[model samples]
Target: MAAAFLSRPVYPGLALVPQARRHIFALEGAGAGALTDLAPDAGALTRSDILYLPRDPDGAAQAVALAALGAASLWQAPDLAALLSRLAGLLDGARMGTRLYAAGSEGFIGQVLVVAEAAGIDPLSVATEHRGNRARRVQCVHCKTVAEEVTTQPCACPGCGLTLFVRDHYSRRLGAFQGVCIDAEEPGSAPAAEEAFR
Candidate 1:
């Protein structure tokens, strides 16, 4: 997954901010990371340097580090609203078309994209893992027809009298941006339909 590292300015003599305690708790619970402690060398930090540390061992560590540095804030959303807000602020003075890596789930990526679109920021990539459940199409035994794609649904054939069973299916819904693309091609080629348009 892609991890974004934000660099915030560290003011002289200011202590490490202790806000977001609840958020940190949630992060730790999620197996992500928490804002445990500041990087040891706080005095060594300059306006150009800040340090954030993650307490857990997941992709979220990088984000925590940035947050500790005061470069970015972590927004916890049932979806993506909070994340977008933090991303926009972090990218305030960044150049147009600057590539960013956001690591989360599919839903998380979607939320960030929604925010990016609203703020006129074009994200270069989104990173996630295959941890959640997904929909799959199975063949029905009764009807000999393919069962409709359903989430956590039993495979009951749509065709004649047959009952199909469910099996472990590998879903590509939570990978990189290409997770949704049906046709597999080289890393950089547009989908066939898009290529046809060109």
Candidate 2:
């Protein structure tokens, strides 16, 4: 429980850093609303680049809305993988005064943080806000398989076939929560799986 509290990420929400020379936004699903709500000034929009991936049913509408915001460049990725790929390239070329902002689910934010870390961006300097479902990314401790969007406790490990107990101990490097086998001492005594993360 203490570990859970300690590891849980806090999102203070995204705001326009007025002093930044360039603004880079990484958005997924309902996360696009954060940027749209900011109502950035024309100068900021002219110096901003947005990479967005719509992950929900109303995603198309959101994409259209985001495109109309008139950022310097807006790329609508078809999927998360493509969005991340583009984000990597964008981060690689990011200038010194560029500010990174991400808004999405916790899992998506973690993935973004990982990318920024690799690009040598200080996590403290990146603005993050959580929006949308609470599904988590889980990494199996036994087989080291990282599962995406895990929504339940006692989730099955896709790699080692273990019934895992999802713990809140998160790894910034893995961008996932730790999942240890639930019944390792008594092989067949694991509790039933239940919806947890949503």
TM-score leader: 2
Q: lDDT by residue for model 2 over 1-198, one digit each (tens)?
A: 633487767789998999999999999999999998888989999999999988869799998999889999999888888988999999898788999999998889999999999999988788999889888899999999998889988899999899999987888888899999999999999988899876
Clashing pairs in 2: none
lDDT of 1 by residue, 135-186 (tens): 3444433333544333432333446523233433322222112112222244
| Ten contiguous residues with the weakest lDDT in model 1 | 5-14
Q: What are the C-alpha RMSDs, in order, of all predicted structures?
A: 15.2, 1.5
> Could you estimate the TM-score for every candidate?
0.30, 0.95
Top candidate by lDDT: 2
lDDT scores in order: 0.33, 0.90
